[model samples]
Target: MTSTQRTSFPRQGVRETAIAVKTRFQSASDVLSDCLEEIARCEDKIHAFNLVLDNQARQRASEIDDLIARGIDPGPLAGVPVALKDNICTREIATTCSSKMLERWIPPYNATVVAKLQDAGAVIVGKTNMDEFAMGSSTENSAFGPTRNPCNLDYVPGGSSGGSAASVAAGFVCCALGSDTGGSIRQPASLCGVVGVKPTYGRVSRYGLIAFASSLDQIGPLCVNVGDAALICEVIGGYDPRDSTSIDEPFSGLLDSCDKGVDGIRVGVVTELLAPASPDVQAAFTKCTDKLAAIGAKVDEISIPELSYGLAAYYLIAPAEASSNLARYDGVRYGLRVAGQDVESMMRATRSAGFGPEVKRRIMLGTYALSSGYYDAYYGQAQRVRTLITKAFGRAYESFDVLLSPTSPTVAFGFGAKQDPLDMYNSDIATIASNLAGHPAMSVPFGLGANNLPVGVQVMAPTLGEAVMFQVGAQIEGLAQ
Candidate 1:
C-alpha cells in the first residue's frame, strides 16, 4: 500500500481526535470503536498486537466520556488509544518480551510510562510483539512469530519494536510506546514508515522497562506523526524518583516546539552515517537535506569518524549489560521453570528451554565479553570506544544544532532475507551511534524508497535537545506532505 492509501484508516491524528472527543464532537467510545474495528480488520495479516484489551479499553473510554459529561477534562491525550510494546510492564497484563520464558508472567506493577499514559487519559489498547528479549533486527526472533510489515506483508517490520511500529502503520492505534536499545525503535519506525523517538537516556523514566541493556535501553514513542510523538513524550517524560537515572528537569512544551520551524537551524548531514546507505536511501536523504536548505536552514555535510566504531562497541556493551540483567530469570524465581534432578541441572534445563536461539546467542556473547580473561580486551575497550563516540558527538554539537541521516541503511527487506546474524546486526549501523552517545534521536517518514516502500530521515540532537529534534522532525514531516 502507498502512503496515500494509509490515510483511510487513522482518519485523523492525535491532537485533532483528542479535541473532537473532548469537545463532545465525538465520544471517547466512538474513537475507540474505530480503532478496535481497524485492528480487527487487519490485525490477522499484520499481527501487530500480542493482546487486544477490547473490554478494558471500552471501559476506560466510558470513564473518559463520564469525565467529559461532568465537565472535567480527562487530560492531554483525552481518550487516545495507545499500544504498549510487550516488553513494557503493564500491571496484570502479560509483558512477554516476545519470549516464551515470560509468556505467562504478568507484571505486578505498571511501568512508569504506562501509568503516565493512563494519567493523561490515554486508553491502553494492548501489548505489541517484539524480537524475543529485544534481540534481533527483524521481528523474526520473536518466539511467538514474526511481525510482518504493514506496508508490505511480505516484508519484515524492523525490530525489536517491530510490532509497535506496525500497529501505528496499520492504523491499529494512533500511537504506541516502544523501547530503544540501539536502533530498536527508530529502525523499525523507518522500515514501517512512522515517527519514532528515542529520547535522551534519562529524559524519560525507565522504572519498569524490562531491561535489554540497562545503560542503553530507553522507552520512547512511536506515532503516526511528529506532533503526536512530541505530545506523548511530554506526557510520559519527567523525573521519577523510582528511576535513579531519571532527569530531574521538566520535559513539557514539546508539542509546542513542533511548530517552531527549522529556520537558522544548523543541520549536519553526517558523512559516515550516509556512506553505507543504499542509493535509494541516499537519494531520499539528499532530497530531505535540500528541503531543509530551501526552508532557510543551514544544511551542510559533516564527518564524525568515531561513529564508525559504534556498532562494534554497542554489540559488546549492550550484551554485557544484558548478561547481567537477564541473570535474574533463574528457575527459582518467576517465569517458566522446568524441574530437574538437581538445582544446577534445573537452571540449565530451564534456560536452555526458555530462551530462543538468538537470546541464547546474545547471552553467550555477553557472558564471554564480561568474562575474567577478556574483560579488559573486549568489554572494557568497548566502554572506552563508547566514551570516544560520546565526546565526538559533543564536539559535533558545538557546530551543529542537529545531525541527519537515513534511519536505516535500506528499506524493509523480505522475511528471511538476512539469515546471517552479522547481516542482521548491520541493519542498525546508521542508528546505533545515538544510543552510544546517550543522545536524542527520531525517525521521520520522508518518502518511499526502493520498491516504493517508505523511507525515514533520522534527526538527532544532543542530550536534553528533544525540543529542537522534534522541530526538525516536524519540518521534515511537513516537507513530505
Candidate 2:
C-alpha cells in the first residue's frame, strides 16, 4: 500500500474501515487489510509488533466474511482487527513475552481473552512487543527492541504493554490486549493517549497468559476510547474454570454501565498518591476532578497514608513470585535452549544467554529475596506492606465509590534516561497500589501536558466494581473531549 492508501484513517481513533466493520457495513477482511496496511507503513518507526500474523488474520477475516454471507451474526466486534501483547498465548502465533527465551515458541492453546475475542469475530492481527518478561516500565527493555511512543519517537512508550498502546495510538489496530503487572497497561495507555483498563485481579482469566507476578497480573484492553475498552472488556471478562485464580462471579456490567453518567457518584482523589505527581500531571488530574465535580459527582481529597509504600512493597512481592514463575524457562522444555555438557550447565547457559539485563536483574533479586536467609527480611516484609496498602484502599473505598489519581508521575520520558533498572521500576509508583489492592483501575486521557504529550487520570474502584469504574471512565472520557 502507498503512504496515501495507508494513511487514510484519522489519527484520532480507529480506522474508518475498522469502524465500518464494527458497524456491520463491511467484511472483517476489509478492516484487517486496512490495519495491515497501516502496520506496514509505520511498524518500522513504532516497533509496535514483534510478529505480524498476515496469513492467519486474512484467513480468519475470510471466515468472518463467510459467516456474514450466510446471514450468521459474527457479533459486535466482527471484522475489527486487534493486537495482542506478546505475553498472551495464541494457538499458532509465537508468544515470546518479548524475550529471546521464547522467541520461537508457539502456544498450543489460546488465552481465554484471545479465544473470547476470536469467538466475537475480531481478527487477531499479531502479537505486539513488550518489556522482557513484563519486567520494565519502558518498552525499552524488550528483547526485540523498544517500542517507541507514536506521539513522540524519542520518548519511551509506557510498558510492558507499550507496543499495544503505541499500535492503538498510531491507528495500526482498532484495539489491543495488554497485561498489567504494576502499571504496564495503564501507564502505556497514559503515554500513548489511549484508554487502558486493568480489571480487578481475577476478573479476567489468566489461563494462557504468561505469568509475571501472578497475583498482580491482569489482562485488559487498550482502545481509542472508553466505550471501545468497555466493549472489549465485556467480551473478555468472566469466570473461567480453567484458571484457578479466575473469579466465579457473574460478569461485571462494564458495557451496560458505560452510558450511565457519573452523576451522584463519589470520586475520591487520593491525596497521598497525587502529592508526589509532577506539577503538570497534578494540574491535569485536578482539572479532571473539577470536571467530575461539575458533572454533579461528589469529589473529595481522601488520604491513604499506606499508599506511600506501595512501590517498595510491590517490588518485593512481584519479584519473589516472578522468580518462582520464571523457573520453567530453563531451556529443558519449551523455548530456546542451548545444549550443555550437563543439566545444570545447560540451564545456566540458556538463562544467561536468553534472558535480557532487566530480566536477569529481577530474577536475581527475586531469587535472593525468596532465599531462606533473606525471605523474612524482604518477601515477608513486602507481604505485610501489601496487606497495609490493601487495607488503606479498603478504608478509602468505605467513603468513596472510586479512587482517582494520575496514572504515572509524568508523561513519557526519553528512552535512554530510564536505563537504570531501579529508576525504571519507579515509573510504576502510582499504579502498583491498585494492583496490590486487587481493584479495577482505568487510565483515560485527561489532557495534554507541558511537553504536549497526553496525561491520563486513573479511576479505580473496589474489587469486582468494574461497572462503577466504567461509569466514571465514560464521564471522564466525555470531559476530556
Candidate 3:
C-alpha cells in the first residue's frame, strides 16, 4: 500500500501542511502567501496579532523552498505557518506580553520552543495579543485591545492566550504557541473552537517564556485539530539544559498515538469540576463522555473534591509569583519609564503608568499575599492547597487513565460580559486544576452551546501522560465531526 500523493496544498492541519510542503507537492512560499493573504483580509476585525512578521515570514518560506529544491528535508513542520503568544521571546522581535511595561522590549535570544519551531520549518507569522502579563481570563486586559472570538465576532476569545487561539480559529495560521498559566491556553482554546494543549508543566521548556507564574506556566500549542497539536507538542517538547524545570525525558511518538483511540482506557469525569458548568456545556460534556464509552473506553464519574480549592490557590500562588517576576520592569531598568523626582517615585510612577488595571490588581493581590504578616495566611496556605490538589489528582489517576471535564463553565461570552474581576476569574475554574497538578491536559472543541458558540471538553492525564491525553482528545474530535 502506498500513501496518497498530494498534488495541492492542504488548507489546514500542521501534519498535512508540513508533509505537503516537504514532499514537494506544495511550495512553502505559496503556503505562506495564502496565510498572509488571509491575515490581510480579516486581521483588522479580529486583532489577533500584536505584530505580524510579513517580510521575515516570506523570507523564511523562500528559504524552506530553497532547501526542498536542493533535496534537503526542512524538518517536520516544513512550511506550516505558526503564531506565537507575545509573551514568548523571539530574539529581536518585541515580546510585549500585551502589557505596556514591556511593549518595546526585544529579547537577545529566542525561546527554546521558538527555536524548535523554526528548526521544524514552521514559518513565524506574528506575535499574538494576550492578557496583560497573562493576568486576565479575557483578552480585554490587553494594553493594545481585546481579541474577539473568531467563531462569533461579538464574543470574546478567552485569555490570556486568547489571540493565539483566535489565530488558529480564524485560519490565520496552522497553529500557534500559548503559555498556559492557570487556564490561559485551554480556556481560550475552548472559546475559540480549536485544539489547545497544556503539556505537563516541564514537558516543554520555559527558558524564554516571560514568567507570569514560574511554577504554573507551561508553553503549549493551539491548533485546529488534535493531530496538529500533538505534532507541535512533539516538535517542541523534551529536555532543555537551559530550563531547570524542563523534564529530563524524550518527547516523541505523540503524533503516532493520535490514531490509537481510547478503547479499554479508564476515563473519569471529574464531578466537582463539572458541577459549575452551564447546562449547555454540561450537555456537550455528557455527549463527549458518551462518545468515549461507545468507543470501548471504560468511562465513569469520579469526584475529586480537592479540585474545588484549585481556583483560590491558583489566584494566590500565581499572583505571588507574578509580583516577584514583574519586579524587574521598574523604571531603573527598561520599558515605559515614567519620569519623576527620584528613583523611588519614578519606579512607582512607571509601574502606575505602565501596567493595566488587571495587572495592577493582580500585582497588589500578590504583594499583599506575600507581605510580612500575610505570607502564611495567603501565599503559604495556597501552596499547601496546591499540594493537596496534586495529591488528589495523583490518587484519581491511580484509578483512571484520564480525567474529563468541560474546559470552561460556559461558552464564549459577549465582550464586557465579565466586567467584575471575580466574575472573570471564575471562567478558569475547570481548567486551573491541571496547571496546579503539573499534569498534561488539552481542550478539544466538542460542539456548539448557547448562541451556537463553541464548547470544549477537556481531557487531562497524569504527569507525562500526553500520549493518552491526545488519544482521548482525538476520539472526542472524531465525534465532533
Query: For all candidates, what are the clash counts?
Result: 0, 1, 0
**Which pairs in model 3 have colliding backbones?**
none
TM-score of 1: 0.98
When 1 and 2 are scored with lDDT, the better candidate is 1
Off by over 4 Å in 3: 1-11
Per-model TM-score versus the true fold: 0.98, 0.96, 0.97
Per-residue lDDT for 299-414 in model 3, tens only? 99999999989999999998899999999989776688999898899999999999999888888999999999999999999999999999999899999999999999999998
| TM-score of candidate 2 on Cα atoms, chains taken together | 0.96
Model 1, position 346: C-alpha lDDT score? 91
lDDT ranking, high to low? 1, 3, 2
Instruction: Give me candidate 3's TM-score against the actual structure.
Output: 0.97
Q: Is 2 or 3 the stronger prediction by TM-score?
A: 3
Quality of model 3 by C-alpha lDDT:
0.91
Please give, for residues 212-251, the per-residue lDDT of candidate 2 as tens digits.
9999999999998887888888889899998998988877
Per-model lDDT: 0.92, 0.87, 0.91
Candidate 2 residues lying further than 4 Å off, grouped into runs, are 1-19, 22-24
